[model samples]
Target: MKSKVIERIAAKILIEKYQLLENFYPDLLSGITDIIQKGKIASRFPYIEMKEDEISILIKAKELSELKIIELWNNQDTEEFRALCSIYFDIATLLDKDFEFKNEEEIYELIKIISFGYLGEHNHFVKNYLISKKELIENISVPEQWNSRLLVTIFKGIVCLVAKHSWKDIDNAVILINQLRKEQKDFESKFLNTVNEDSRPYGSAELVSLYHFAKTVEILGQYLLEGRVNGNEFDIENKIKYHLSVAKEFANASANIVLEMLYKYFEAFSIKLINIKTMENKVTPNQIIELINSLPDSEKHIFIENGKYWVTQEWLCGAFAGRAFVNEILEDAVQEMIDYLYKHIGHDSMVGNSVTKSGFPNLERVKQYCTPVESEQD
Candidate 1:
């Protein structure tokens, strides 16, 4: 069967399953005009190709989309009702991933529905349904074998923890985090004990594990640092920040180790930045930029435009070279390194947010690259 056809059929089933189209149903003939004008629904379900009844329904959808029926659906607070709305949002978006439905109000409604479980839904029908979905998703692990298997498991675990937040208890969250921290520490301790400086450098398994550990720490750090559990801010923010800081340290260490393990394998390994100490033939930032410009468009894009670490890539490589050898050419590179640190580490820029609790220091470069928010409330 065609996947799109299956999805369309499934969408109807899901709407009925969630019982959304009933309570929030608009006039049967009301169409979502915005979807029609944008050609979103028309392209997917062409008006000419559809049966008479299907065409009527599509017209209704087009008009309802125009009238913002989704927003109206969100105003209802019942858990079953909110879940029904989520089904529509999921169906509309799944039909066209890039479609701009702008249905956050619907999503927020579902979030509210689930939030009731955190408060007092021990016997509620919605609570049981949410828990069952959570369990089903949690049970499906990626079918990978070997050392990479650990990475898959860890990744799934992280995702499950994130999803579980809506229905999980805060005390449970704290307990789970602490347990993860202990597991992480224990795993690291055992790995370190198994390998010392004289041992063979890390293999793919070790590399994967380090990456997973870093990501796990980052996720834990964001959760604990942000204090997102029930609206009440954590009673011990200091303790939480400290825990997150330790996670940050681990993530940083993992990044450094990954760089050390993989840098030589890259194609750009031949180009070395001059060391400031020995004062050799050093390249200026302009010269470096020109060299980067000389590269093929594809390589240049990877180096300077969009890939991970692209902005910091050049500076970091130069710093690495400076430490690798003692040459006079690297003197300028060293000074440039200092300049980079001074500019990024200690300054605030135009994007400074004086109101945030974290008081994150402004990064001029990050501000320069930041995407603007289209909606004011966002």
Candidate 2:
């Protein structure tokens, strides 16, 4: 048979089989169809093409019992089979509340495939399904034999998904983020202890993981601030602050290992703080200044040399300087930060170009504090 013909046959058989099983499965057929449709659409992007064999694998996998499916998953190392495993996991969530893989290794492999493989279409479904499985995710114990970095990748995937759909379960979202925060701290502590100065520069997996998870928490916090809350404004504001605190802690811990994270962390923090100051009316200019001052002075010296300025630091300074330019109340405190940055990084660099290019308001005043390359050179 032609490959296209075989794929169509496999797809038809799978659709019909899922339809019949839907009576017992509930939404099983629709779920598979949704996965296929989305997968096709996602394949339009480069480096993510869906193969015809994947459909055949899904058809064969769907017809087998759960135990057989697991056996197949364990035995096969092909991309098509991994794609099938991802689909099986997604459908299993609907079928069994207590459904779990044979071991953490299997779980890790499945997540690895989902995170980096051609399973982009199943991500949304799996993410939504896992939202209700917080206990399952939390209870799964990581054995000492399993790779901790793989575990981090799994949690990072979960965190990214939950953070994106935070509105679905706000409280659960917060709990998951807090859990990830603790796990990150524990992982970093252990990983750092094993490293020496020679390996420290290359030991960025944990740091990058921290950056991703921290950003997700920050995103979730931003979502909470923007959405209508059942509680008081103080409650929401406190939550936002909690999220920011987590980011700050991560930034401080990672500063020595990866200096760029510090700049990125402050950039995100400054934007969120500005939002709270302008929208919530809870954060004061003094409070912002105090927080900025609390950042370690050690990291600032990196930019003190000529031609050593990082674009990230420029972004960080722009975030505050732009806000200060628009709000008179924030001018003095923000100017203090900008001056401190300017004194260190100097005026020969593009200080606030990011803010200006982003179309920040009060452009003329922002330029005054955040001198552009053209103006500085002139």
Which candidate gets the maximum lDDT versus the true structure? 2
**Worst ten in a row by lDDT for model 2:** 322-331
RMSD of each: 24.9, 18.9
lDDT of 2 by residue, 8-73 (tens): 997786565444334334533435555554454544564665466545434433544233334454
Query: Clashes in candidate 1: how many?
Result: 25
lDDT of 1 by residue, 212-318 (tens): 44343343433432322233333233333443344334434554443322221110110111011113322223333333344334242223222222323222223
**Candidate 1 overall Cα lDDT vs. reference?**
0.35
Q: Best-fitting candidate, measured by TM-score?
A: 2
Score each candidate by Cα lDDT. 0.35, 0.43
- CA lDDT for candidate 2: 0.43
The per-candidate count of clashes, in order, stands at 25, 0
